[model samples]
Structure formats: C-alpha cells, structure tokens
Target: MFFFMAKKDRDYFLSFIAIVFLILHLHVSANEEADRIISLPGQPKVAFQQFSGYVTVNEVAGRALFYWLTEAVQQPSSKPLVVWLNGGPGCSSVAYGASEEIGPFRISKTTSGLYLNKFSWNKLANLLFLETPAGVGFSYSNRSSDLFDTGDIRTAKDSLQFLIRWLDRFPRYKNREVYLTGESYAGHYVPQLARQIVNYNANTNHKINFKGFMVGNAVTDNYYDNLGTVNYWWSHAMISDKTYKQLMSTCDFQRQKESNECESLYYYAMDQEFGNIDQYNIYAPPCNNSDGSSATRHNMRLPHRPHSAVQLYSGYDPCTEKYAEIYYNRPDVQKALHANISGHIPYKWTACSETLNRNWNDTDSSILPIYRELIAAGLRIWVFSGDVDAVVPVTATRYSLAQLKLDTTISWYPWYVKKQVGGWTEVYKGLTFATVRGAGHEVPVFKPRAAFQLFSSFLQGKPLPKS
Candidate 1:
C-alpha cells in the first residue's frame, strides 16, 4: 500500500513506453556517417590511449555520436567487452566511469588529473566508455540546432551503433562476450541498450554477440527509485521535516509539476546536509532539477564541475561538507592535487545536457516489454544496485522486476568474497538482482572489491555470487 503503483496505471505507464519507442523507431533515425573520432585535449604522460569515435545508429542518423574507449595496460584474454555508462539520463561514462569509478585512474588531489588506481576494472575486461546521445562530453554537433532534444531512444540507438563500430574497431571482439555495465541512469541505459542489441540481432542475419549486462545502483523505476532514495535518506537522517513536507506538499515528480514552495523547501533541505558519501554516488533527490524553474536547468547541483571537484580533493579540502562525502569531498582526493592538467585533460563533470534531456520522455515504460523480449532471446540479464544508493536503490529494481514473475526463484541470497560480505543476491526465473553493500548510485567507487566481483560473476555467465 505504501508504494502504490496501481495495476491499471502501471499498465498504461508501460503502454506509453512502448508507444514512444515504436513511434521513435518508426520515424527512421537519420543515417549519415558523421565524424566519429575526437582527440584527448591535453596530452599527458601516455599511460594509455583514449579515443573518441562514432557508432552509426539509426536513431541518430547522419551523426556518428561520441564514445570514449579505454583499453587495458595489459591484454584481456579475448574476454568480454564491457561497455560502461554513467547515469544522468545524460551523464558521461568517460568522466565518471573512466576517472572516478572503475577505470584505471583516479584523479590526483592537487591537480584535476589522473592517477592510476591499483584496482581499476579494466584489469578484468576491455572497457569502453561512452559520451552517448551526442553533445555529451566532447561529442558535439556543428548545428547547435542538432542538440535540440535528446531522449532515451537516441541514446539506445547510439549505443547499439557504437557497439557495431566498436566491434569493427576491434574486429577480434566481434563475437566476444559483450557485457554492458553502468551505474545510476545506466540502469535504464543498459536495459534499453541490451534490448536494442537483441533487437538488432533479431532483425539481421549477421548476429551480434551479447553476453550479459550489469547495473550498479541503477535507476530502474522512476516512481520507486525516486521515492525510495528520498525515504532512505530520511531514515538515515539526511533531510529534516521541513524538507520532507516541502516535497510532500509541492512537487509531483511523476506528473512533472512542482510548486514554488516545494522547490524552495527542497533546496532548503539540501542545504541542511548530504548523507554519507560513497565512492560511487549519484546526486540525491534523483536530480529532479533542484536547480531551476524548468527541468532543462534543474540538474546543475554539483558543488562544482568535475575538475574543480577533483582539485578540491588534492588538498583534502572537503569542499562541500554539506553534502555526503561521496556527493562532496572533504580534504579532497589525494592525487588530484599534483596531476598535470593544464593543456588538455578534458574535464567533463556533468554528462549530458539538460537542454537535450528534457525533450524526450525520460520515464520509459517500454522496459518491461523490452525485458520480456530480451529474456525470451536467451541473453543473460542481471540488474544490481548499491544498497546505499538512493538514486537507483535496490527497492526500485525489486518493484519493477516483481512484474516479471520469472519461472521461479532459482536461488536467492547474499554473496561474499574472501570471506568478506559483498552484498545480497536474488535470482528469480532467469533474472538476477544483486545489491552491493555500502555502495551508492555508483557501486564501483565505494566498493571496488564487490564491484569487481559483480563484474566478474556476470561476465562468466555464472549465477551472481552468494554471501
């Protein structure tokens, strides 16, 4: 009763998702080969190479789209190609995934630069980072007009196309076990991307290989993830009564409408204090544009841009103590202080432009059908979350997946590694959901060990690890 999404309403919600997708696909995405590759701005000590290129997807026809590819220092055993996406509906995978989360390097404290992390995920698989939906990160369109409105449709299209081109780039991995992994918004991104991959496979004779997918603290269902994140924070003492009531009284997130009082009250609450920081975290309140009048400018809540964030860490500055440690830093990160980033270490803090995000229906109802379709296709599907992550908490996923009613609960429980608890795991029918402990929206940042475990487990197509 508390989390009431009526069956009729849910059904309608889902139907809308399918219709939007059907309409978008029917339109026929523009298909011209636009420029794909872009250079890394400032050339630093070349520990590795990061290249930008386009994956020709039908959704964004005539545009190559931008994607960042990070290779491992050592060779991966023709393993799986794990594509990483950071959520924001428009977040950039390169900045968050490559720099902050599991990518090989973490920015130094003194400089807004990169330092090698001993436990980056690249050690396990070939990592591909994307600045999807065009206009994210360095990917751009000459026609500012082109940046008009971006939606999940174009995003999935770009991802599918990028996969094709990526395979072309590394033809060897053409049939490799391809796993899509991401955090927060990627919950939505990964499912859709996986669905598209399946769709592509079904449509064409040239079958593209797909192994599985992993989502960490992903935004699975808007209604639940949004509400659960807030309630979780309150239970943890992040927000006070004034703010909670403000939210209750003023905003209707589902309806996409808000009152001035609600907006004012919410910001006042945020002004109180952010919750516990996690290595992998998303902006709390699920970023409903606490920043402005329109959703267009609503997401700029970062204490500062990405570089400034890392820079603050250099001195261990603890820049925004008001927010959680993960959301903000105190005393900053240790290495970001000394990295050489003057010329071109292109720093993209917030991925995806709000201007673009607002155009399409972010709340995609098509996923249920998409999920049903994918499972029917034999593609391994797994959705995992960081328990602490309010953004895409496990609860939202649980609610969404409940509808699937798989054949049976294969085996559901917790997973552990080296005798250390990673998180809880649940398998029903064929779908699996694992909740990583002490992790936020971004699972890898807070719990690298668990993150790697989750990655490795799914990559092997084995049952998710058990406690």
Candidate 2:
C-alpha cells in the first residue's frame, strides 16, 4: 500500500509518522523526569526507581497529601499497584509503613544510615505509602484550621481526591489492578477509601480499577474490639481475677457509653494488664528508656524508644520508631525525599500526630456495615491479625468476624511459609481471615518473612500454603 502511493505523498506520510513517535517518546520522558526521585540520603544502591512528593487534593486550601512510591523489583509495568496505610487515625504511612515495615529500606541500627529490607512489598508490586488527612507526616494544609478539622468521612474524601490526582501525575498506574492494605486504624481507612472508590466509579466517567483490600490488627467494631481486649487480657493472665470480674459485670460492651464505674474498672484493668510493657506486642520488651507516660495513649500504639541492641524474639528492633523519627527530621534527608519543600509546615515530622489524634472527629462506631457492603459487591476481602498484638488482638478480630456470621467455606487450618507453620487461616463466604504467628501490631516489622508470604498469597488471590 505504501509503495503504491506517490513518492512525495509517501515521504510526507513517513515524516508524519516520525513526528507522532517523537511526541509520544517525549511525553513518557517528561513524566519520568517530573516524578523521578534523584536520591535519598544514605540510601543503599538499588535497581528500582523511587518517587516522593505531594499530590494536591485541594488547591484553594493548599491541601496536599504526601506519598512515597517504590516500583516493583521486576517488570514493574506489569505488576499490580498496592497502597499501604498505617492506622493511628493520625499516623504517617511514610514513617511507619515505609521506613519501619514494608518499604525498600529500614533505618540502620546506627540511626544515621539506611539498609535494604529484603522483604519489601515492592518485590511483587508497585508499593505506595500515603501520609493522609492533611496533617500527618509531611502532608499539610495551608489553612491552620484544616489541620485540626479532619475525621473519617473527610479523610476518605480527601484520599479519593489524592488518588485521582496521583494517577494523573503517574498515569502509568491508572489502569493497574489496585489493592488497598493497611493495619490498625487503617481497618477504617481502607474500607472507607474502597467504598469511596466504588462510589466514584459508579458516578463518574473516570474509573479506578479497584480490586480488593486487606487489613491487619484493624479496628473494625469498637464493641468487639473492647470486649476482645478484656477477654485477651484475662485469657493471657495479665489481669487479676477481680479486675476480670469487674469488667464482665460492670462494663457493657453493647452500650454506646459506659458508666463511670465501668470506665474506672476498664482503666484499672488496662494498667494491670499492660504495666510498662509494649502493649502492641505483649511478649516483646518495652523501649528501655520509655517512662510509660504514653502508655495510656491508644493512638500511640507502637511507640519506639531508643534502646541498646538487645535482641528479642524474631529479631524485631524496639527502637526503629525512634530511629525513623531522627532520620526523617534530618534536613538533607527531607530534601532528598522532596518533603516539607514549602518550609511552612508548623510541626516537625513524627511517626504519629498527637494533635491530629486529639482533634479527630466523626468516627463511626463500627465499620462492619461497610465490610458487609464491600463483600456483597464481590470484592476480594482479607482480614489478618498479628497474634501477639494486644492493641487490637486476634481475639477481637475473631469475635468481630463471628458477628458477621459468614459461613466457613474452609475450616481453620495452619498455613505454611518456608516449610514452617507461619499462621492459621480460615476462608469464609465473603472474606478470608488469617492470623500471623508470633507477630505484633506491625506484622512485617515483627515477622517479615511470614508477612511477605501472606502478602504474596493475597495479591495472587491464592489460599495460603497448606504444606
């Protein structure tokens, strides 16, 4: 067909084709430069590209959310996109999720360097960590009042907007299979965000390729969570018989508000149960220098205090949180991450924002109803618990699932990783529940290999290994 064309016309068509190709090439090149992370301070050499910056969700308010993305270790273009959130209701996914748990690197023991995290989730997916709600981590809002005016509904709306803008910035991920995963309060964040995405898809021309979501040690139903906490403490023999009796007799789990006597007894029981230990992982040692002043702060679930290199079970570092705080605050480090570029952020970065936690509003008593809706929509849902986490224990999660009354498709059984039992799992009609053995509130930080295996199975939509 080309040979049949007149010589001048054929040359003209060839030139047009060349021009189109050049334009396409330049488009990709521009995107690469715009999102490229030059380098991170003290970062180890790596094969994958990383990017960090703000995606403005509201231009008028100067509201932006911070994100750090690590492309998959291999064939990133073909892999799924996994967004991870950490649940303090005010936690920084960058500080907790990225630095200490599942990102490509962890703060070195020396506190001044970085080291490779062999079990980084990006090995199998393009992992994204978001610091959301406008006041956590490096995310910020220009309006001072906006920092304190955040809640579950507002956070979800802002997060949906952040995702839409983020996709515009990194358009390559627009069509990828998207999965939401988070721990603790993220139990609330993940479901709410998923619901918003579903609603957006239903109403708008632009669509998100939403697949499924996974949560660990999540706060789902306050009634079950509180009840389970008491039961867990009693079962673990952490509380006295009298305290247990008081909890059972005086505290009404079903009540929206408990009596003064019940509140007193509950606090007493918690004090007896936790003492000076790290409540997130009962068996793990508390940060040596911690004075226990933050013990009553539930939102500060995984507080890290600097300590000596005394190894604990699973080689978990009790001081990783402190190390992350120091690393993130370094001027050069912030510059490398493209964080706090405006110099207008009022506070230094912390793993969890105390102000945000105090000001949080519009919390739903239970997210179980949202779960039910998502399940019926046929989205693959998996709920996991770190068995050693007392903050939101496995017992609480189990009780919450029981309330849903989803019939078991597969009976409870041990799941394996590396020829060893990593956890126990059960498949229900609409969800899968699993427990990670010997893990704490942050499963990946406490049991990296098992956590990675669980993540791999979830992304593949396969049941955990039985052998």
Tens digits of per-residue lDDT for model 2, 125-166 = 999999988998899999888868788998999999999888
Question: TM-scores across all candidates?
Answer: 0.70, 0.90
Q: Per-residue alpha-carbon lDDT of model 1 for 1-467, expressed as tens digits?
A: 52488888888888999999876544432221122222222224545444444554443334545555565556665546788876665555655677667877554544334456666777777788876766665455444555676667767877787788666655556777778888666667888989888878878886787867777666555455455555665766667766766665665544343456655655566444553233124332222224532121222221111111211212222222112222212123211221111211233324345555544444574266777877887778788877765444566677667777786565667689778778888776667778887666566666777788887778777776554
Q: What is the lDDT of residue 404 in candidate 2?
A: 90
Candidate number achieving the greatest lDDT relative to the actual structure: 2
Which residue pairs does candidate 2 place in steric collision? none
TM-score of 1: 0.70
